[model samples]
Target: MPRTVSELMTPHPTVVEVTDTLHAVAQTMATQDVGSLVVAEGGAVVGIVTDRDLVVRGLAEGIGLDAPVGQLASEELVTVGPDDDLAEVVRLMREKAVRRVPVVEGDQAVGILSLGDLAQALDPDSALADISAAAPDE
Candidate 1:
């Protein structure tokens, strides 16, 4: 059976506004136990902010916690469709060097598919799972 991105995606991912402070975004991530947040504006996704983005783009650049996430978020989003083939989406992820891609229906973000999701779906015991789940500096 051909699987789909929706089948493996984490639905209704935690979200925050583009104007949200980094502190608030971090709090949401920690509370949700998610590594990334869908950056939204007027209920429509505009970008994505990940923990790595916080470190590499926010802290490393000396951007204060009170600053708007829009400054550090990835404005050029690479997204996928819910019905997209899992294999094709995986290929896209590798080609684009993205760990996660939002699953969009029109302009709305309905879910997110991460490399970890693929690892678990394709091979639950694969080493990718360990690497994907590993905490930074581990």
Candidate 2:
């Protein structure tokens, strides 16, 4: 049987408020060792911010790190419910070209699922090896 998204999702993913500073968000991501954060307000997900977002949108735009995260985050939020099938989640991620997706329960965010997380859960060695091989050499 195929795994459900709930089975693969990282429960209780870290979140940040729209008012949070980009520097603070970066600190949170570093502390949590996560690449993305769900942007929430009043217990509802409004957007998402990733490390790439900081580099591509923030830095490229000359926005200071002290600027509000909401100023640079992608407002077109894409989300999935815990009960949603894994295939559906993958499809949405592919269509949106996003690596991370927030998992919602009603109006609140309950977890997150990333392409890496899903790939690892399904097949660790092969997935990791593939990623490693595709990564640019340092």
Candidate 3:
């Protein structure tokens, strides 16, 4: 059977408080080489902020890095539970064009799942086999 979200998720994903400065969040992302950060309040996930959000929403709007991350965070967060199937997670990602999704438990973010992680877990070799099998015989 394919692995579930809990099997593939990165536990204890790096987080940023809503009150944190954008510059600080950016620094955290840069240091960790992650594309998104879960925004938490009172240990509960309230929103999400991404590198794209920083560039498109902040820089494009002339908002300084010193501005609070909450100003640019997306409050309508789409999340997955740890027990959710990986296939469902992948489907959601494709449908939303989002690269990262928080894995929540009772509204608290316990992990994160990224496209790269899914790709690694699913393995492209299976797709290659399917494609080759469908090709016409020589």
Clashing residue pairs in candidate 1 are: none
How far off is residue 127 in model 1, in Å?
1.5
Report the C-alpha displacement of residue 36, candidate 1, in angstroms. Answer: 0.5
Could you list the CA RMSD of all candidates, in the order they appear?
2.7, 3.4, 7.7
Give the per-residue lDDT of model 3 (tens digit) for 87-106: 87889989988878999999
Candidate 2: which pairs clash?
none
The lowest-lDDT stretch of 10 consecutive residues in candidate 3 is: 129-138
Expressed as tens digits, the lDDT of each residue in 1-91 for candidate 1 is 4399888898987778889999999998887777898888877888899999999999999999999998988977889999999989988
Mind sharing the TM-score for model 1? 0.90
- lDDT at 45 for candidate 1? 82
User: Which pairs of residues clash in candidate 3, taking residues 3 or more apart in a chain or in different chains?
Assistant: none
lDDT of 3 at 64: 94
User: Candidate 3, TM-score vs. the true structure?
Assistant: 0.83
| C-alpha TM-score for every candidate | 0.90, 0.86, 0.83
Clashes of 1: 0
Question: Roughly what TM-score does model 2 have, to 2 decimal places?
Answer: 0.86
